[model samples]
Target: MIDFHCHLDLYPDALKLLPIVSARNLFTLVVTTSPKAWLATSNVFAGYENIKVALGLHPEIAEQKAGERLLLLSCIPKAKYIGEIGIDGSPKYKETISLQESILNDTLTECERAGGKILSIHSRNASSRVLDLVEKNCRKSTVVLHWFSGSLTEAQRAQDLGCWFSVGPAMLRGANGRSIVASLPINKILPETDGPFTTNRSAPLMPWEAIDIVNTLVPIWGIPKEDVILQIRNNLAALISEENFQQNHSDTK
Candidate 1:
């Protein structure tokens, strides 16, 4: 199974869970909330090719870590995946919206300069602004909006800009989320667990549990579960190939 966005390092028993995840052969993109976290997590999963660590500075804490911009930029050239990054406009974080935008802009700019990256973004209540920056700065990069909570129009706009969406069980449990997923193009959808933060019956969701998302999509897409699984696999393969092709083309240029 593929978990396009998960916080593997944030799990309380991360080390213990490593073997279980490895045994399941779950392809996971572990997105860190800070550059420091990314460095440590990347080292921890160095030899595990199935587990990729993305360098990120989450918008919710953008103000506090504004000084880490240079560190983020320095880490960009080495990071193939960039994410858990974007603007959050929820009431609690609304005050730092401008700062978050600035950080996101610089991050995207640096990623573009580094010849593009596969980004897992967080858009909370700022999807429009986040999409705006992505549209303005992205060229060779591939973007996936994680746990997206936006209107149909905004979702369509993002689709038009070539952005993919990552849906999780936590999101699927909600009526609004189901509505959003039903409206999106099936080929552009990817599954995520967003675990340690998102719970299932009060227990932290595991990366392997991302497969549960297939069952949820089954009813929404009016397709069989096996077909849903195959579609997700195909989507992941296509995304990976697209990123690889972009990287290769960039290298040639």
Candidate 2:
């Protein structure tokens, strides 16, 4: 199974959890909320091929730490993945919309110049703006829109621009979620657990919780369970395969 968005550093037992995730035959993206956290978590999961630690500067905190935008740019060359780096247009963060856009623009420009970074983005209430920037600046990278909450028309626009969407437990429970999933092409769908933030019950979800997503998609897509699993796996491979990664890396040169 694959979890395209998981905050490994936020877990209570991150150290203990790493070993299990490392041992499992799973592909997971360990996204950080900030560049500082990325540095620490990258070191912790260093040399583990199965888990990719992404460099993220969450928009929720972008206003106060606008300085990190430069820091994020500097760290781009060393990173294969970029994420949790889009705008959060929720009421609380609305005031900092400009700052968020600036940071996101910087990030996309740097990634575009670098050529092949796989990005896992978050666009809470600012999907149109986020999609606009992505369409403008990112070309060689594979983008996975994590927990997209935009309208069907917006989703179709993103799809036309070649954006992939990642879903989790919360996305499966709501009617809007089901509609969004149904509207999207299955090939563009991926499973993720924005773990330790999104929950199934009282506790925050674990990375492995993405397994439930695969199981749940069976009936939703009307595909057999085995086929659903393969489709998801293949979708991930198509995005992060060695050939694609190498091509992106080569484009930078």
Candidate 3:
């Protein structure tokens, strides 16, 4: 199984968590949201070979001394993806939005030269501008929007921009989440736990919790649960492959 977005660093018992997952052959794409977690996660996964990591400045921690942020990001040698990065929509988040964009731009440039590194963007209330910057500045590899919350028009724009969409456990409990999953092309979709970040107010997810989320919408997509899970994993490969997603541009005509 492939969990495309999870925070492995947040687990209190990180060492214990892996044995259970490895015995079952579950793999994860871990996203580190801060300089602290970024360092810890990279070391924890070092030599494991089964984990992939994304290092970036998340909106909540986006405002930082520029030198500090860049240095920490560059230190993660295992990092091939950039983000859980992008604008957030709260009054407090507004102050750091510019910092987020600045950090994101420089990271994208570095990723571009580093041979098309992938990204996992998080766009909350700023999907329109997220789409704008992605369309213009993404000379890097594929950019995936994890747990996307936007309109169909925005969704279409995202698809047009070569950004892949991911859905989470929230899809199981509500109309809005289910509707978003129903709207996406199965080929471009990926499944994630957003693990420690996507909890039930009680327990955060382990890797396998992703299974229950996939099972919930099995009938809607008209495929078997096992097949759907397989496709979601397959979609992860496709989305992360980078060769498949080509950035589209409109010329000044």
User: In each prediction, how many residue pairs overlap at the backbone (N, C-alpha, C within less than 3 A)?
Assistant: 0, 0, 0
Positional deviation of residue 223's Cα in model 3 after best superposition, in angstroms: 1.7
Write model 3 residue lDDT over 1-253, tens digit each, in one string: 5567787767888778775654443456788787566777777777654566677667777765454675655753456766667777668788878887777766666666676767888888888877777876776568888888888778878888888876777655777667777877888877678887667678887766766666765877998877787677667656655432212211110
What TM-score quantifies how close candidate 1 is to the native fold?
A: 0.93
Tens-place lDDT digits, model 1, residues 1-253: 7788899999998888776676563468899999998889888877766678899998989887888878998999999999889999999999999999998999999999999999999999999999999899999999999999999899889999999999999999999899999989999998899988999998998887888888888888999977887788778779887444223222111
Clashing pairs in 2: none
Worst 10 residues of 2 by lDDT: 244-253
For model 2, the local distance difference test gives 0.84
Q: Which candidate has the top score in lDDT?
A: 1
Predictions: Cα RMSD each: 5.1, 4.9, 7.5
TM-score of 2: 0.93
In candidate 3, stretches whose alpha carbon ends up further than 4 angstroms from where it belongs are: 64-67, 72-78, 240-253
Q: What's the TM-score of every candidate structure?
A: 0.93, 0.93, 0.85
Clashing pairs in 3: none
Model 3 — which ten-residue stretch has the worst lDDT?
Answer: 244-253
